[model samples]
Target: MAISSAGYEGTVDEPQWSDLLANGGGRQYAVADAASWKVTAGTADREVRIAVGRGYGYGVRDVSDTVVSLTLPAPSSGSRYDLIVAHRDWQANVTTFTRIAGSSARSIPTRVQTPGTIDDQPIALVRVTAGQTQVTEIVDLRVVNGSLAFDELVLQYLNRLGTKVRIGVTEWDRDVDSVGNPVWNRTDVTPDTGWVEATRNGGWAFQYCQFRRVGAVIFYRIAAERTQGWGAGDNLAIIPAGFAPDVATYVASSSSRGQGREFVFQTNGSVDTAIASSGATNVTLIGSYVAPR
Candidate 1:
């Protein structure tokens, strides 16, 4: 029978042909059967649904019975399918099918068709080999150029058994040393002590400190304000615990005035001695210390 709509020209079953002319409707037919129909002329758009059975619906052939081969429509830019169902027997073991207009066809399973493992959770894409498909949870996934923004980050280094090293930023204060010599002692500034310690020479204001350890090498940055002034042979600051310099050497050019005004990490203890400079000014000490683990 001939199917005729307002502008459709095609052949269909007598029942469908009559319905098309009487109600100006579209039709759904099996893909295999649609191959025989042709649209000669039609200005009005009509939809002809094509069904390719793959055991998902009632009475459809079981996906394991025969592999189903389908030629998918050319993909559009930025288009993605949330679900794709297929068979493994009809054509071969191949399941899903995808094709872009200008790219090679991809047969791998690229989407989830139903809720898997966890209730109502969709499974990610997976590769299926021969035989019936089996579902498994995806453990690891990687994305290129992906960014994760976080308010804070905690980094921990662990040994074979447990955590070994932990690094983080903490507030410290400058306190008077036990020897009564004006020394910068790293103290917990919880009560907001202002981190400033007034010594006989000048006042040392502790700004902040960053500490990190890589293997046996420890790196530190200590920033402080030098008020009043300092003279030669003054122990300005003390290295934090677990970070005493291994050798007795001076960090030259550590001051704005340069060379002669330097700092030395005493080999005997964690004390940092500042070689007398011309005047007292704000200073930042940044250096690496070799400490045994």
Candidate 2:
């Protein structure tokens, strides 16, 4: 509980400086979980498109890659799950991604990363059928989360937005109206769910933002000017704990042209969406999610 600034004058004794990443690769206290390193199906079935991405691994600002193609090994005599992962290896002093070949079984194995600096960001799962050269099923496993030095994003929401939230008088599990109307069976939760107006990476100025949570339902309408680092598929706001959905919650929001834009709320409180153009930095987020407790 000492009062000290983060990396003042690029000093090593100060707290890990997350805000000064570009300045001689400042320290990264949190493993960045953003979409900078996105992986998708490449031009060929055996190839994967790895977009240039940036990440922080083990107190060091890791890699940011340009789009490249990675060809995986051919399938063997038995079906197995080959995971495509992006990680920074401190032992080799390199930040890159590779294919981890699972055993001839079904279970997904853990990463064999260096224990000292293990930053494994799973990109996708390539299921290989026995005796096949080209892949058929490429499951997108990249989670559109973000980085936080010492959970600064968490502290921002806690210190700035902790107030009396609106609570539902009587939350419910089952609701029925007419004799033969639709009956709803919902999970039970109280005021334990809430959301904060959050942004990506570091600094971002907000405007006209409001968020609320009642029981298992959370609503948010926020807009912010992007003034700091941003990555593809990063979350804008993080939903509080105890209300994470079993699956990702999707909400279709109206675009400026009245078109629909999809937003996903993940189990780790990451509110995700498609990558916006670099020129379009002013972002407006509005949606609601019903948590499946």
| Most TM-score-accurate candidate | 2
Error of 2 at 3 (Å): 35
Decoy 1 TM-score against native: 0.29
Worst 10 residues of 1 by lDDT: 149-158
Candidate 2 lDDT tens digits, 1-293: 11122322234433345433543243222223445555666767477776664444334444444576778776646666777766655555455667888666444457654535555545666766756656666655533322211211122111111111111233222234577453433233456434554444244566645556776676777665555434557566665454456688776545342134455678886766654434445556676666455
**C-alpha lDDT (0 to 100) for residue 204 of candidate 2:** 56
Q: What lDDT would each prediction earn against the true structure? A: 0.33, 0.51
The alpha-carbon lDDT assigned to residue 78 of candidate 2 equals 62
Which runs of model 1 end up more than 4 angstroms from their true locations? 1-202, 253-260
lDDT digits (tens) for residues 40-152 of candidate 1: 11122211111232111111111122222222232333322221222222222222322212222222223322211111111112221222122111111111011111111
**Residue 251 of candidate 1: its Cα lDDT?**
68
